[model samples]
Target: MRFALLGVAVLAVSLFVMSGQMGVPSDLPFPVQVAIAGAAGVAAWHARRSWWPLAALGAVTYAWLVVWPPLLVASYFAGRTLGRGRGLAAYLGACLAVQGVSALVGEARDGPQEIMTASLGNALFMALGTIGLPLAVGLWTRARKETAEERARRLEREQIMRAEQVRAQERARIAREMHDIVAHRVSLIVLHAGALEVRTTDEETAETAALIGGIGREALSNLRDVLGVLRTPRPDSPAPDLSPHPALDDPDLSPRPALGDPDATYRPQPTLGDLDRLLDQSRALGITVTRHDEGDPRPVEETVERTAYRVIQEALTNVHKHAGDAHTDVLLRFADGELEVEIRNQRPHGHPENLLGTDLSGAGWGLVGLRERVELLGGTLRTSTEESGGFLVSARIPA
Candidate 1:
């Protein structure tokens, strides 16, 4: 579009120069004037795309004749687009070349006295309107454009900085919440599960209880890893090349392997297949757990599986923390492109108590984290206390 405008301007200015000359110009022949005008049009096209071409074309055309409007326009654009020193040199050189050629041509046509007077008058007019004015305007336009671009870039940089600051603050907030609240609840669950291991004499129960305790400890470790990522200062070096959002088919969702431990292995994440193990762990703790699955139980997305497991983990942990000895029922329903998990427990027989001596006063951040995890996967989580007397936790997630 801009080049088209330049083409139109070049044509219009060239025709105007030709018409304005009429019969008054005689230093150059009519054929040479027409040829120079054609060259000026070509120069205009090249000038818009680059300064070097304009500089070269301006030097050629302006040195030959005085009635070339395209050369003046091209010189102005070269000045605007090129570096300050280079642009100024090109503009001045073209102007000087024009005056030098006019003087030589005029001297050859008439006597030096007659030619000098006419050339001086022509040079003065050209200097003010053609050469000096265009250079000044181009320089002014260049300065204005550069100033506007700088301002726009500064605003963009500021916006990106502000966004990064906000993200850092949010990460810090999540870290604090996990430390103050989530860590406490998980610790209690681990402590209680460990207590069950010692208290139970039944071999099967002890082994199952030990497994649950080990799982809880592992969870605590992973939780700490996540916390480290949130709290640690950003690395000075570039982050590892990894996808921001891994494909659903991707087995690993972590952006990169944990730093400083090539020997350290990533633990397998829990999914629906691990649901039985989770229920068995709770059962070993002397809680009555009933699980039922409806619809053909098939494989689902990792995120959906992970979130569903987390929902159950949180629900069962709450059962241990706040509703000891309660009869808990877990329901899994797989429907068209969705999976739903519902956990409901009957009223506790008495005061809340865990296998551990801890008072079981939950720190309350588990549900907060659970909700965040679920919503992040484009799922909805709902929890409520039944009027009949118990708590219910539910999650509906994409499959």
Candidate 2:
């Protein structure tokens, strides 16, 4: 508003001086003309922000004839920029005030008779030309600028939202990969260490194996704690239980356990042959899972078997989380050079409600981790909602 006022004042003063040089309104002193222009600028500036200021300015402009048309023009634009209702109000108020002031001044200077003789139509013509058109143009420009700015701001917000989503997805992917790879290996180490401690007969060897087992258990505990921090679980997810282990939690034990003899060896890990055992365990837990082996069962590379097993394991895990009692079907198809595994679950019925129910819906990166694992083994996995309102997960890997 200040800038607009300043610009108008400068322009008006320049024009007035130029007109004075041409002997027009030359009777007014130079200083008086500058003051009139300044007042006009100030009034115009106020007009843009509020109707009251613009109205007051309009009255003052009417009393001061030297700043007539510019004041009127400024008020019109101010009104248009303000919007139709307010702008029109300002424009009309200024116009009427100008005419009223003009009439009173004319009566005082030229007498009531001469003032009444002047054509009222001519005043109306000047007001329409000077104020009406300028106000309309200003309003149009203001509306256009506002619309463009709104669209740009909306797009900027959407772009920022998309970037945030991508960052969240990447964070989840990293967390899942760490859990799948590191947790599996660490679990194996813990298992082997425990077996060695139980089997060793010599006191020294047994003590060393016991130490290794203690370290592995502590490591596993620490790993779970880290996962708790990384994976922000949903409301329904069970809180991780990090209860102290009786053997590993001895107060006399060193704060950090020393590395013992790393002689514990893991047994050949379960491959696809052990899937029947997995299904049996699920069945024991009251989950109905039917398995089908298509084509002649044949041996495959260790990596392929391991990946296939993990895929089914993850699928089963997800089912247990969402709907533990749901019936599921597992299919293992062996082709010439490829092995395909499919696990589908009927929509969840319901689980027995309890405070300590088997709800292990931890970090929701199970599927994401499984996909990455499968892809790493040159396999493709697809999961989708079934038309029958169930769920389907399928994976194919080069055998």
Candidate 3:
């Protein structure tokens, strides 16, 4: 709407200037004058795209018919568009040449005496009005536009910096809480598990206690890694030492291998290849699980495998919590360009309430975290109750 109004204003002003010029004596016919006025309006309207063409036409008309308005508009656009070098110099030179030509034509008609007096004064007035004033205003407009864009860019950069600062502070706070609370508790669980393993006389009980202690120590080590990342100054920095802290060491506990050690027990990220071990752990807890594979097995990206493993891990954990002793079916379908993981458990033999009680019924954040993990890999996770009173958790991930 603003541009339409501007076009209308330009046309009106062009016609007004042309009409006023018609009163002055000229050899050009009336229709020719009207056509030139129409052309001037069109040139002014399109001056933003290429002002040089308008400048050329305006220079000719200004010299021949004393049409100054179109030339003035063209000069303004030229100032806004042209650089302050060869382009601007050439335009000023052309304007000077046109002024000289106009003066010569006037002298030829009105004689040297009038040219020296009135022509010189009129030439100065025309130069100031047609070139100087409009050109200055156009340059000012260009400067203002550039300033506004710079300010917007600066504000955007500041906003990003502020957001990063807030995220860093939040990460630090979480790390502190986990270190003070979770780390301490897991350490104690590891110590107790170690003591249990030593005191047990039965071979199976000692083995189970050892497994618990190993799992607990691995958990503590992983928590240390998490805290290390949160407390790091930058993401690209070297990882902190993965060895257990001296404070967490216990004489009853066997030494776990440090990261980078040849016999390290901890794997930073688990993949689908680790699914067997996970299944064995569940089976050891007395859950009947059957595994099925569909389609030809193929190598998948490590990240995809990790997310897939997590989906199944979280699902089986849910099974243990809510559907104890349930027969669970684990399916891995490798399709053309995607991998599908489905874990479905049949109805438990006993009431879910009587299974493990509420002690194992976690805070329900595991499924939420699993969903986020799957979606981050451009995948989908779904959980629903089966018609057979079973629970189904499914995930589809891009390979």
Candidate 4:
């Protein structure tokens, strides 16, 4: 709006000056000239974004300054350029309109060629009038439009980035929720299993105690697998694999104590402590359970200690569930700074029984939790059925 006012004021001063040099009557009726000037002023005032007003005011301004030939030509070109393309076309039509009016008003005053020949200045104005001002102004307007468009694009990109940041934060929050739920419930199960094992001595109760130990070890393994995503690098490892433990399930909240758990007096969690007993329990279910050791059972960290216990626990549990009345081999290997535990059992020819009465639904989560636990302690776990019809789970944990 300010710029429109400025352009109009500039045009007015130029016209008044040119009017004098062209020798138009100073005594010309103030009323007629004022009326023309008022129209130009109004057009300029309304030219906020509409090209019509700019074209209209510019056309009229040129028509009134007839004698000072340059002003007439400048006005025509300026109007056309002010609104290029369709606007320019519209401006040309308006110019022709103003020309028609001047022709009518001065029909008796002078002839057309005579009007052109009257001034040498008009000829010079025509050459520049053809292209100069219009082209320059058009490019200026195009550049201004481009700048505005770039600014809008930048704002849109910023909005998308902010939205993505919010979504990532939400995903991390959900991941945290899942971890807490599994950890809390599985820990409670281990607690009870440890307590019951301590107080039970009857044969049936002893079997139940062995099963509880197996389940607790399964839970610990599952917890490790789930937590594998957060595996931190140890100085001796390039890629840490928390091998032994796997996955977890929530039900009946059984208890199995942790390695060094104060509730169980930090007793060694079922590691080598129950290898013979684990075989006895599996064999009692009529599954042929065998054992193997590759190297000496030497000193190892609690992380390795607990993971080893969990691996054997889940393997035997799987045999109990899916390979009842089948041959099972439990192999332990201590090599380098790592301990490897492998459990392989033949797939039964018939439908397998529970062998023990724990929920099968709860059994599925075992491997996943085991992997998490193993990875967290710089270990790796692999499980699949072998070509000979046995399911095999193998884990190696750093000591």
Provide the TM-score for each candidate, comma-separated.
Answer: 0.57, 0.45, 0.82, 0.36
Q: Higher lDDT: candidate 2 or 4?
A: 2
Candidate 4: C-alpha RMSD to true structure equals 17.8
Candidate 2 lDDT tens digits, 117-175: 13487456545655666666777887888899999999999999899788767756765
lDDT of each: 0.70, 0.64, 0.76, 0.60
TM value for model 1: 0.57
lDDT of 4 by residue, 1-399 (tens): 684665577446544743464334333466666555555555555544444554545544445444333233344335434555676565556555665554444443454422532344543343235334554555576667779899999989999988877765664455456556765566666767667777777767766766766766665654544444334222233323333222233333423335453323122356676678767766766678788888987888766777888888887877767666778788989899889999877767574432333466776688899999999998899987676666788998887
Off by more than 4 A, model 4:
1-11, 14-18, 21-27, 49-51, 64-87, 90-135, 155-159, 162-170, 173-399
Q: In terms of TM-score, how similar is model 2 to the real structure?
A: 0.45
Candidate order by lDDT, highest to lowest?
Answer: 3, 1, 2, 4
In lDDT terms, which candidate is top?
3
Q: Note the clash tally of each candidate.
A: 0, 1, 0, 39
Give the alpha carbon lDDT tens digit for every residue of 270-300 in model 1: 8888899999888878899999899988889
Better structure of 1 and 4 per lDDT? 1
Regarding lDDT, does 3 or 4 come out ahead?
3
- Tell me how far candidate 1 lies from the true structure as C-alpha RMSD in angstroms: 9.4
Error of 3 at 160 (Å): 1.3
- By TM-score, the better pick of 1 and 4 is 1
